[model samples]
Target: MEISFTPEIRRAGLAGAGARLLGVAAVLVSLLLLLAAGPPAAADTTQVRALLHQGQDLLRAGQNDAARPLLLQARTLAQKVHFEAGEIEALRVLGKAELVHGSFAEARAFLTQGVALARRTPGQPGLADVLLALGQVANEQDDYPGALRACEEALRLYHDQGKLRDEARTRNGLGIIYSSRGDFPRALAMLLPALHQTQQLRDSALQANCLTNLGGVYFRNNDARKALYYFGQALPLVRRQPDQGALADCLTNLAVAHQQLGEFRQAEPFYQQAIAVSERAGEQAQLGVVLSDYAQLLTDLKRLPAAQTTLERARALLEKSGDVGTLAATLVALGHLHQQLGHGAEAETQAHRALALATPIKDWSVQESAGGLLASLRKRRGDYKEALRYTELAQAAHDTLFTQSKAEEMGRLQGDYQLSQERERAQALARTGERQQQRLQAQQRQLWGLGLGLAAAALAGLALWRLNRLLGRKNQQIERQRAELTELNATKDRLFSIIGHDLRGPLHSLHAFVELLAGPPLPPDKLAHYTQRLTHTLDHTLALLENLLHWAALQMGAAGPPRPENLDLAALANENIGLLTAAAEAAQVSLAHSLTGEEQAWADPAAVRLVLRNLLANAIKFTPAGGTVQVSARRTGAVWQLAVADTGRGLPAPTPLQELRPETLPRRAGEGGQARSTGLGLQLSRDAAARNGGQLLVASAGPGQGTTFTLKVPVAETVEVPV
Candidate 1:
């Protein structure tokens, strides 16, 4: 059975295919015409035309200062002669020159005036050019949406006029606008076609611009080799033209591409050439950027001295020119350079300044760089906690940049996929046109299924990408926790070792004294001596055990808040002196006590008792035979100061009070060589005092000179007692 092919179905398929074909064909034709379009006609007067030409020539050569006066004269003369077209052209040139010199307001004023004049004139010939200049001004000011609007309008004008060359240039401008927004794929799509059209027209200057823009897109996309290839192709073309500014930019890009690839040796000469060209043309802004980049290259090459000099030069130029964008970058490079030179303070200063400058501008690249440098500087200075903070900030910035880059990549891929889908849709329509009516339905169904499948695949891919990112973050967190656990385990083992080492001597002495007491009774004199010795030994052992318990409580985070109460500083001092009096007499050390007034203290009573007992015992033990130990208390404003002074064997040298840890304290024999120390008592005392809102300070003048221990605590308020 032969199936009839309905005309209605055929027409439907043909119409759909034809519409898509027409749209594609129209875009291609428009691009071709733009490539062939000639330059705009000359101004009305010979003098106006000459002035405009000279100004444009000078502007192309990066001599904006020299070109401004000529353009101004042309504008004035054209206005005087009532030459609207000439005035428009002169205004356009002046606006561009002003824009290049960092005068956005003046450029906008001139360009807006030119646009207004072109509208009032009969033909409005210069309107598109004025709009294009305004778009560039918007781009320079970082107004992306404004730039896009202006460029699109100019593109429409050029398309309507069949001005292919102007359209090509506008397309390149659109690419640059997209690039500034970090949309690299969109940028490349606009730039590549423009480059092809410019090459076809054999416009050397335009072609060079297109090549440079393509290189920039590739550079931003991290395609360094392709960027290098395009930059190399543009270098000779820019040199051949009269555009010194373009040549300088080309040279700098080449140097950057090489430097990124670790080809520093090959990059140096290009940087030098770029710097020389910018300097000769008096392009201070461009010179500063080039010098800053060169300094970065020098810093990477370990040529620190040269990098510093170059950075200083760049800083001076950028500051004078008010180029904050480049200045921020220069400062980041300077910070890194200072870090490499071991000037930590200078590095930190520069990094902070860079962050401050870049933050207001929202220059994320500069901010990220400065944060990284600051992190490194902090780490080098041993400020690890603060270094970690900067590191996290830098990482966040890096992730943001990476996400932006990935989005651009996705946009490019999506654009390509959409183009392919359009082609397929057209092809399916063509096939439908050839098929019978019965098969047409089947083809339609097949096409719908294919589109749905493609969409589903795209969604799945995006979902998988997101899932992978989440897993990566989770893995990073797990790794960090694992490292922390490892460190904690090491600390636990060290603590156990210290506890065993400290407790061994005291335990052994206590065991020996217990065994002696349990043995047979002795004569009266011998028994008295044994009893006294055993008492001292038992006290020393008990003190050591208490210190260890306190330390363990502190380590375990079980030392709860201190219980503070009011107490007489003098009474506490006398109590401790009496407690240590027996030991002092046994050592043949004289004990003395003195107090003035009430000398009340608001402190944890237990902590104060431990502190006093430790200090008095240490003084008595360290004192030689016939040495005197003096305990005194006094009131100083709203604070109580207690001093424990001894004519004892002092510390061998000056030791920092802050560094008086248990491990650092000296273990020495007493006067009779019967008493030995564990060195934990002083550290424990200090820790206890600190917990009670008090401080223990030690002063010593070397061996054989007396040492004094001063304890300071807040005074308690006066309270009424029973009459």
Candidate 2:
């Protein structure tokens, strides 16, 4: 039995075969056109046109590396041939090749030159192409404003020439730019129409491009389901083409969408496919992007070793490709990988390197990512203060990007809708009465209807009026607050000035006495006796004045103590002992010093001396004849416990230990039974010790059994500083 193939089945089979044949023909034609063109002739203008066709063919074949050299050669030959239109085409192709290779600087140079040449050569078909190429370059460089301007110009030129295919391409380009800038709504509007236009023209390749761009928009808008749907639709068309560049792009995008949806199993395969295609095509820069993205995915999946290897490979590829932007991103990804693997220092180094690259490029996204990683590393090292500062910087960068994106999106939408409104108004005037009424009725129910617009305007005006009144009151309140703050600051400054001046007098007098006593103008015995007495009084007076100043500073919110430094506590104790010796002898108190263990502690030396002196002086003042005052220190497991034990009248009643407030420390009565405190010596001592990461504790065995004031200071390894 001979089976007859029906016309319908034959037709279907032929259609499918024809599509595959066309794709193969396109690839073969591209290669042949490039080879046949050869080098342009110096005086042959026709050769320039042939070279342009060759460049276009190479571009269609996704051979950017081959295309770039050919296009560049064409541009040079066109210059020699004085074929300005041909030169513009060559430049446009070169720009596109550079953009695909991630050479944004070179792309900009070529595109700018193309734009100038196109303008000079009036009525050239290449002008719109050049503009579109420039727009694509700008979009890749993240220059959204420049991209939008170029796309709009290209669209206008294409529309004027009735080039609907070119117009659709420009619309798709605009959609990609808007989507990147996070204008999803406008991106959708531009891309959906472009998709429809391509589909209507039955151009599978252009349709795939539009679908890919639309998927990107949906992904950016966080509609992963829609994004995946569009991406899937584009894939079959992309796979049918011999180039497969769009297929790789769609696969990568689908991977991202799946990753966003937490479908890592599905995403991983797509990423691998994209990477494999990029590698086979010898697209090093695109390969690096896929690898870096995959590395990030691996890091998220806790595959540290694989992520590290992938990021390193991407870095190597990016370095060779000279794409600093993607290289910086790879470095940031590596930094995160290191951070995840518990390598804080390595993470910091990588993040800093990324930041260094990103800052010069002014790529805010990379800069922000690097900065955030660095800040997190610092926080992990227990540097919250520095982390906070870096966090603020990252936040500012994010805010700037967000605000600019929002403004650009709003501006584009308003411009497009406003133009549509004007067109509708003009058409309404040109219509018949019945048609005009029908149009008005239809528009009344539309979202951007005239009635709704008028109502919105009225509400906006009312809101603005109320906002102005509220702002006026808020401004007045701010002014009053500022004035009050200024007055309060002035008062604080005056208080500090008074305390400084008052304390300086006594300090200067004491210094003068010490200077005179140090000179050789008096008898040795007389000098010794006089100096001993003067030193005792000076020490007391200095202590009193120092405490008063510190207390005043604290009250004024300016009590910032110097950081702790390594010092010998034994030496400080001996110095204060010498200063208080005469007073101890006069009071009949036996003062002794002892060191039980090698005690090294971190503390402010001046503060420690003052504390020791105050306790010693108080013991001397209150002790009876032959009473003993002992100063001793011992090491207690990472702490240096320094104790000032005294056999003196310690308490009048039940004493508050842990409940003691800072204000009560310097209020003890002297040997003269005076209730008044000369200064805040004890309070300042407590504050200084606390600042150095330790605390002061006072303990006693009831009334007259004696008291021991122990300062538990933290011990640290000595750090040397140059004088």
TM-score of each: 0.41, 0.43
lDDT computed for candidate 2: 0.71
On the 0 to 100 scale, the lDDT of residue 64 in model 2 is: 55
lDDT of 1 by residue, 1-723 (tens): 000111111111124465455444434543444345454332336666767776676665566665677788778878877889999999888887787676889998999899899999999978998889888887776656666767878889988998888888898888877876677877888889889889888998788888988898899888889999999999889889886877898999999999999999999999999999999999898999999899889888888999999999999999999989889889988888887788889989999998999889878788889988987787666554466567656655665565556555544444444446556656865664455344434444555577776765666567557756865786687679768755655545444443444444445445544544565554677567656665666677677778778866865668888988878777787788888787788788998788754577788888899888888888888888899989887777877778898998888885534323555557786666455786777878888888788888877787888888888889887633424
Show pairs that collide, candidate 1. Answer: 33-164, 34-164, 34-165
Q: Report the lDDT tens digits of candidate 2 across residue range 233-265.
A: 999999988875556788899898899899888
Which residue pairs clash within candidate 2?
Answer: none
Each candidate: what lDDT? 0.76, 0.71
Worst 10 residues of 2 by lDDT: 1-10
**lDDT measured at residue 441 in model 2 versus the true structure, 0 to 100:** 57
The TM-score that candidate 1 achieves is 0.41
Output the TM-score of candidate 2: 0.43
